[model samples]
Target: MPNTASALELDAYLRLSRASLGEWLAAIRKISGCRDMACRLHNGGGPVGALSALESEQGFIVCIYASQGMDLTGCRTSDPVVLVPLGGEPQIARQGGRWQPLGKLIVARPEDRFHLRLPELGRVMIMRPRTDILNNLVNSNAGLPIAECHELIDCYLRRSLFFRDHNHARQMTSELFCRLGRIAREESKSGCDCSGLDRRLLRAVDKIRHEPDWDFNLTELASYAGVSERNLYYLMKRDAGITPYRLYQRNRLTRVRYRLVDCQCMVPHISRYAADEGFSHLGRFAALYREHFGELPSETAQWRRNLLEAESGHSEEPLAAP
Candidate 1:
């Protein structure tokens, strides 16, 4: 049976001081494709500099939290970010008058023009999924509203910076993606704020995402979405730039990628994990993973193993960004 156990705590690499914050900001700037964002800082005492960051890499999601140290007002980003507070009431500027108490989660859409005050020294986890992915998931959410996520958000962020084992991260990433798709589906149902084949494309992807091994033939999938295979093919080509099968294939590779980065002492065999995800062609799977993620599977797993080793020894080496 797969390990379902979990434990949690803080990892020291997450401790960001003012000086370290400067360094982090500088290094992140050097990363190509980093989004342009601007923040005006209002510190209670000195510059509000302490923050804890955890990025669930396989899912392309990030969680950053700040407590009583500083209140960031008039903060804006080009994309939508889900903000879940781990402590007190973190208020966005526009909703200052009626901000709810301890359990409110904010979906900071691009047009929100928001200001956030973090007085409780609470941790906030922000997940940034692709904009088009959000659009697809939103429209086809099958009537599940995003507002219902307050409790789920709390549960998701409870692990903080520490995940007890490798399987924990994989499970969290998969579960989070499903919840995000549901939230987006619910959010899109209410308004015309939209894009991408009106959810058919996203729905197909979501099916594959959650169950990579499910037998979803093209005809069955297309018919399920109330369209013929021919129309479905063109819609995917036009909107997502790929066929439904191709998208499913990619998601399968994603499952394999998660296993590749398992951070455990006795990591599972890469070939076995890949095959369990239905990849019989180990060489082809490795090549595809390399092409997509820019590294071989073994190398990725080793990097994580080394990271934990550094952490256990409390080596002051600069931590690698996920």
Candidate 2:
């Protein structure tokens, strides 16, 4: 599985000191091969300096930033870029370029010295493709040259970053990357052909993601994918490195996390949320929610409410136990 960590966790691991901006930049440069990277400190009450990094491995590079507003300039290898803002707003400008009003999410590719002005503490995830892997995909797909590949990537990134239809963007990008990876792998082997089973597997995965609330069983999912139950199990194990049931649980849990942490919804309504995510049994849903998020459903909901109330300058009474 791909490694994942929150920005705060990654910042502590890197040990960035607020006292010295030069030292912080040096650390980022050493670790990420980021040359000419620098940020001017924003005069705010929050932390003076913060940085986080995520190793991509076979995935795309992801960086999370949360600091006071500042002007930023940097240059890395020529690669596609996507910047997703989780909070606040910022304006992004290319080198020697005009300023563009950047709202919730922004995606751009600047060959060098991309300029950005962040006015507040903002959380943004930056994704960049592995160049060699991307090039290989292009070479293997006869119709897609390196230039066309870059354009397609740019399109995907832009749509993902800017579109209000986040569900569509996420689904499309995930499918595109998986398809490209499979094509590249097959092209490297002799006499490899795309199988009917592969199409079925992809459809099955998509259905689970798009309709998590559906009453889907192993047999139903297998039939939907146009494969037998045994073949479905074998294919999921071979391709996704997990069983179909496990994948379903993971996806459902992920939705719960997004609601609890990202959306800051209340706990009493968690059962409803779980139902929306396809959990029909309250006991099983609560058990899985607690296991995945390390807290009872009610506790998670109260925590989010407290956070929301705090953010909104409202004093909220402590939530009673469920």
Location of the lowest summed lDDT over 10 successive residues in candidate 1: 3-12
Best model number under lDDT: 2
What is the alpha-carbon lDDT of model 2 when measured against the actual structure? 0.52
Per-residue CA lDDT of model 2 for 103-222, tens digit only, reads 533335446456666665554545454565555544554443333334444444333322222233344445545544554555422222223336787888778756856665999999
Off by over 4 Å in 2: 1-91, 94-124, 127-197, 258-267, 275-284, 293-303, 315-322
| Clashing pairs for predicted structure model 2, backbone only | 267-301
**lDDT, model 2, position 223:** 93
